[model samples]
Target: MTTTTETATHPLEILFQLQDLLLIARKKSEQKDRIPEHLQHVDAAFREISARRAERQERLKAAEARKKALEGEIADVAEKTKKYQGQLPSVKTNREYGALLNEIDGVKREVRAREDEILALEEQIATLKAEQAEVDATFPEEEARFEEQMAGWREEQAILAVDAERAAKRAAELRAGVDKKMLANFDRIAKARGGIAVVKVMMMASHTAACAGCNLRLRPQLLSDVRLSKEMVHCEGCRRILYWDHRADL
Candidate 1:
């Protein structure tokens, strides 16, 4: 009778090798998470400045419209004053001439008020233009800074890409050496638990154990199987595959 010898490799050794690859992959993912955070302030500032520029543009248009209206009112007042002066000579009585002169005075006052309004509108328009100029000068500098930051992010991403490729290749080699079902289960658990599927549990004593991932106490039976390395053992608390490191217990 012919019999085959079963493989004697320990599951913990396989997981230890897998953890090294996972740490590299996790580092790349975490570095990617920081890219957007670094640019958040610049992005928010751009949006706020853009809104201020739009509001100023609208105010400028309103000021120009007010100036034009004031000019039209002044012109109308001038025509009315001219007509009142022509009527002055035609007045028949002293009272009539006095009333005509008072009317002309009122028209002159109206003309002055309109001209003052036009001057105020012109000042407002100038201030708005200056603010717009300031924004225009400042926005480009921020834009250039944003571009520089983006370039730095791209450089880091390029480096991460190479590291990720190496990690993935190592992970593949490790996966092939592990039991197919264990790998599948590990992959599933990692997907559900954010890239952490296997964990080392410290046996506090022969009967007491603590899961490293969740810090939950491990059941005696579960700890025993993990120590024996006889079969796969999963933590009841975190549901992560558990392995005991003898050095940690020592």
Candidate 2:
């Protein structure tokens, strides 16, 4: 009772299935060959190291400022001591001479304290300089490594771009050969089915056949249509375009 329209072969159906396979392959290959996430970690590490270097430089500047301030204090104390010593020869009373000598001793004590502080700041500056040099030496190597990884990623992306373009062109050519109504139906199914618009029926060892897209059992009538391989058919359960896999024996 089946008319010719129901039994006629649809070549575009096979082309649709081939296009879907190509799309899946292209997507998977692009995903796998893309750059790994470690490149971002490298960039973060560089930023952290650069920040630490700036912090050390600021600390060194503060130390230098403290050292300079202490030097000025020491100079002022020395000048005060000299002035007090020169005034002691013109003093007529013992009280004035005693007070000037006391002032000179106090200034000398301050000068000694200031010199001790200067020495401490100098030691801190030296330590900071050594740490900065070590960081500087390591930074260049890290930056170079990141640059190399970025270059590799760019190259890989370029290759994937070419492959994707060729695949798209081939799919377009295949689509152009298909009837507009069939192509529209395929696209609608694909949009609803996560890029798996068509699938070949797969037979299991248990002698049960299933829709490869949804793994549902095929009905007796649907199975007959699939076995005939004359007309394009869809799985009633999953609504996916169905094709026979003669190479399933392989």
Candidate 3:
């Protein structure tokens, strides 16, 4: 069971409204799971397209890095081949000359292999760039379409904004009316207890009343006090103030 802040207009009543309003004012959007299906689809589609575009850009970068590394390898191999070929003229024997020729051939083959890799990377890079360009061309339209399709979500967001503003204004008024010490106590408890300081009593399975916050069985005397609603009644276990909410869902 929950106590709504807007229900009873006393200090407790003000607290109930304030608690609910505080949470409401904090919300900027509906939870993902709670978003309506149509809006979810629109949002998901936009994200998917965006992810695809991002993936393409990332792949292009990786391809460019690989290409650069291969080009460096080719340069190093070419330099080695030049040094080996230069040693040919200074060879003292046919054996040394043949060894130098083999060394040059080996380096040449290595360079060819790296050049082939560079070519492949260049091709892949071009493909990625084309795909990215496609995304760039189409993504704006997709974004516009998503925004158009999410008209309902946009409307809901506007409503939430309005409600949050109203809640904030009302909360300010409620805070002004509350005793400063009580308000301080409420803020302390709410912060310590995940933003819920005022709570309703729950009837347990055995038909005994319990603290909704802590689910601790309330003493008869405490429950009686809660029912009287004369002053703040704190739950023994949770230390959260308890209110007798007749509208509590049993």
Best prediction by TM-score? 3
What TM-score, to 2 decimals, does candidate 1 have?
0.51
Please give the TM-score that candidate 2 achieves against the real structure: 0.50
Per-residue accuracy of model 2 over 1-250 as CA lDDT, tens digit each: 3333443335645555556656855794666465568676766777887788889999999999999888887888788889889998999999998898899889988988888888888999999999988988987887787778688777777777777777777777777777788778788888788777778887764456789988998876787788776667898888988877643432
Q: Mark the regions of model 2 whose C-alpha exceeds 4 Å error after superposition.
A: 1-13, 21-34, 43-145, 205-207, 246-250
Candidate order, lDDT descending: 3, 1, 2
Clashes of 1: 0
Which model, 1 or 2, shows the larger lDDT? 1
lDDT of 1: 0.81
- lDDT tens readout by residue for model 3, 25-144: 766433322667756776777898888888888889999998888888888888898888778888999998888899988998998898888888888888888888877997888888
**Top lDDT: which candidate number?**
3
Whole-model lDDT per candidate: 0.81, 0.78, 0.82
Question: TM-scores of all models?
Answer: 0.51, 0.50, 0.65
Q: Give per-residue CA lDDT, model 1, range 1-250, as digits (tens).
A: 3353645556766876787798787788677656568677876777787788889999999999888888888888889999999998899999999999999999999988888888888888999999899988887887787678678777887888788778878988888888888888988888888778888887677678898889999777777788876677888888988877654443
lDDT of 3 at 141: 88
Error of 2 at 111 (Å): 48
